[model samples]
Target chain A: MKKPDTAKQMTIARLLLQGNEACVKGALAAGCRFYAGYPITPASEIMEAMARDLPRAGGSFIQMEDEIASLGAVLGASLTGAKSMTATSGPGFSLMQEHIGYACMAEIPCVIVDVMRGGPSTGLPTQGAQGDVMQARWGTHGDHPIIVLAPSSVYDFYELTIQAFNLSERYRTPVIMLADEAVAHVRESIVLPEAGKVAIEDRAGPTVPPEWYIPYADPGSGIPPMPRFGDGYRYNVTGLTHDVRGYPTTRKDEVEPLISRLFSKISKDIDRLQWFDSYYTEDALVTVIAYGSVARAGLQAVKEARIKGMKAGLVKLKVLWPFMRQTIDAVMGNSSRILVPEMNMGQLSREVKRVNRGNCEVMTLNKYDGTLITPLEILRKLEEIYPC
Target chain B: MLETAHPIHKYLRSSKKFPHIWCAGCGSGIFMNALIRAIDRSGLAKDDIVLVSGIGCSSRLPIYVDFNTVHTTHGRALTFATGIKLANPALKVITIMGDGDAVSIGGNHFIHAARRNVEIASFIINNQIYGMTGGQCSPTTPHGVKTVSSPYGNAENNFDICALAEAAGASFVGRSTVYHTPLLDRLIDKALDKKGFSMVEVISQCVTHGSRWMGLNSPVDMMKWLKEHSLTVEKAKGLGETERKDKIIIGIMADLDRPTYNEEYDRFTR
Candidate 1:
């Protein structure tokens, strides 16, 4: 196993951990004190791990009636100054859209882990599929800003879960860790990061006194410090368009600014939010762009393509949303063709095609048959894209 | 000036522009008044109280109150309150939901929250009709009542909010009407102090929708109707089933000491 950079100052044990188990460990490491979720396949282990570990780590866990209530509970706990999260599959994630929009509008910091399984509705319970990519972005109504991170491996799941919390806390918005069934259930050897070795971020609290605290005042940062419910700062938080004080409002000026600020706060800091890895992209005619478990296959296919004397590279995305346009543009500028291999009907590939602007031939390799995209399948697609 | 001098005024947010949106003779204001009076009487620190509400005319009560308040989505206030109660366990969490918000769209959360028996005071103001969306028949709209959604003499049966709470395992359940302000205040007080899920179903009048649609012309007419229709739980015990028909039983429906969700969670976790 490769030694992780976060593992330092102590002898770390290389333990075999599943992707869902890694997520629970990462959440605990990041000071997550509250978790509320329902059981859904591929995601049930995440909720189970949280239920077992959260109590031991001085946090709270609740199995809500449904995904809607689960997310609602997480949002409530977040406002009480607790780092909170929930996990679900496709159908449950669909139910959570209502509060996901609420979280975006209210600017409550929380995390949601969508362990993908096949679905329009309960399509494949135990099997894997990546059908919720667009749902994660546009599931919640309105043009709300969201951060979605896609983890490629079990170790990546552990690290990105922590990153998801950091980003959510720093931005005061919801972060989604979109993992497919393959990576979520896969067991792999991963070096555990030492406690306090990895940097953990806590949401900024009101520096001003209770009376002086403006719950939504952004002093130019577009992000404001939040106060807990019992922090003596008696404030109102509503889903409606509101002013700096957090009261419901319909005035054009107040409504316009609140909406604009929510987007600007994250979009402006796109540089910090975007995370990905490019392999052999320095010199390649064809590059494969993918995320989650498919990205792992993409990496292996790229190596096989190189051995076959075909110039194939891979761009594995860690942060999916605010879609790394500049990086994709850079790949487009260099590569003659782009191949996006995913588990859905070209969800991420559609974004790549939009960004491509016909600059390069953007091809897609999609499989939604509740199976992982194999390296051989991607290699075959690469061979078709690049004549070797 | 007189309104500002009122004791409950101190609990109202000075910044929120309010000549509240409730129509003239609306019982929502009456329930809001009783709620604030009860909170004030309890002497819980204002900072230690969190009032959460779902979307409705009744849900707007939290915005006017000077406490840590959250006006959440439709029918999801109890879920949010459950989180807050478990997170702090010290903050007095209260939820105010309308009839439609509580028993219809949010019915699943309502039953589950009660079943979990989280330490939350849920005040469901059953105005019978959806007042905010203009007089649609709610889950609590009486059977055969004519409203916008059920204009041709309704076919659906109404939910008994208190009985539902009792069945769902809420530790404390009570019913009161706007006409019974003292009883409402007392019930609100008991709910706030209860250890587990405490539910108070307030049979309130919505002058604009519920009352006008029901042929009750004014708030006074509705209050008189409530007074005439409701019977104390103690008084109903002596009456036969036929005699109690159409009577809205008011007063404490259930009060049993049970282990709260938070207390039980803390018992093992801590």
Candidate 2:
């Protein structure tokens, strides 16, 4: 049966969709026309939703042989100028690491939604953990820049999916949507954006003639305009470090320019990529840092601490990668102590400590038992940090 | 503009991309020449056709062709080809892979594409060894053949490339060797014309690496050996096991009527 135009059929301006369902809706609204994925826990709902809804929206969905091919297919679709995505967790993410690296190297625009599960290799399939935070950045080999975004609630899940597509298209690289099991499986009410209101972006195609089109050249911006394969540009594409003409080259000097462009394209625009929510950190003595589901608890702890007439606050990152020093500076400006409560044993905490530069006491309250660190635990830690 | 009228020169980017990485006397060059002829013979628009190849000497075919091409990671060409086909069914996609690339590291994607009957032609150049990686023993390396990876002679059984594809439910499966250049081109053109998943296995040679090690050192010796070892399907049929043993049956292994993936998918979506 065909899924009706859900946006038009809605009774209210809101949708009570699960985080995973919201991800699909957001992708649909954001102009994703191709999705290829292999089923994995805490992430399979995306595949299910796409399987049911993508066709109705004139999109394509395929269950690939494995996670590697899932992303390979997604990249393939992206090459044809079709917005593409895939979702996986744990081992599947591990399998996709190399292909993700390929996407970064080739500068193919696509989205990857990774619903975090307890890992290190299938440590816990059904449980939540922000353990993949580091993997999202450095899982793939080599030194390539990446854009990663985390959605804490069902609403952010929907919002971030749209943002993920927009960023991917604009930047001409794969964007990772980082959501833990707590966020992806959570059910919440969200006032969905009006139909045709969500902003969408498309990758620039070659304006030059077929012979003049260089696949990897600087198209004014550091990023090159990528033409769809059948659009007659007929330019060569490779995953190896290449010259602006897109032919493989091993010349050391040429490698410098190719890699530098890959990094500078993202780093130079770090501010635009930087996104986070700052709550009461202006004058607070104690600051909490969290993301994904942990941020939800961190938010509660901030409110509870404020209720007790204490100077406490939080900084939750919506965009994780292209980690900005400005974000850390803003979060730590007035706070004497920084508390990082995470599902993993401190993936983001380590980065926070490094960026904090020993300016203040940065503490990591970590959980690794495939469970969410509750707000009560966060509050208790805060109390211990400052008695009475 | 008149130069582009030549069918072979139209698809083959020999002018700008010459001195290919293939070794002197390597059959991969022959197979690529035949493939271009096949593309020209298929009569598809150049813009609507794409060549995707994984890492290997055989996979380097796309680098020498002017069509929309993708030189992907090793063994991943099939998935990339499938991606291109699925994304735009209006476009025609083809993959160039080596023995190791198509059935070894890329075994899963190969069989699945056949099983799913995805609309794409897979032209596997079975050079019997990892030509680029220095004559290493590959999945298609014949048993008892000595190579770097199989110094004491390989114990692994070789895959019958066409048989495996036919068993996997491919709609079109054909086999020919570099010696049969015209016949090989015809097979590729026929496979490309088929609706669903199709495969054309070209028995290529790695003259630099595999030839000396496998005792076919010279071009003449290799050509002679290829001609002797592989027999026509019609000639080999009904022969005794002793007569047919070690003989590579080269002909149409399978051709069946089947609905393509895009067709089924479009119907379901509608």
Instruction: Name model 2 segments beyond 4 Å from true.
Output: A1-11, B1-6, B14-18
* lDDT per residue (tens digit) for residues A10-108 in model 2: 655766889999999999999999999998898999999999999999889999999999999998888898999999998999999989999998899
Per-candidate TM-scores read: 0.97, 0.96
- Give the CAPRI class of candidate 2: medium
DockQ of each: 0.89, 0.73
lDDT of each: 0.91, 0.87
Model 1 misses residue A371 by how many Å?
1.7
Model 1 DockQ, alpha carbons vs. true complex: 0.89
Model 2 lDDT, residue B40, Cα: 71
Native contact share for candidate 2? 0.74
Residue A64 error for model 1, in Å?
0.9
Q: Could you give candidate 1's per-residue lDDT for residues A26-51 as a string of tens digits?
A: 99999899999998887899888888
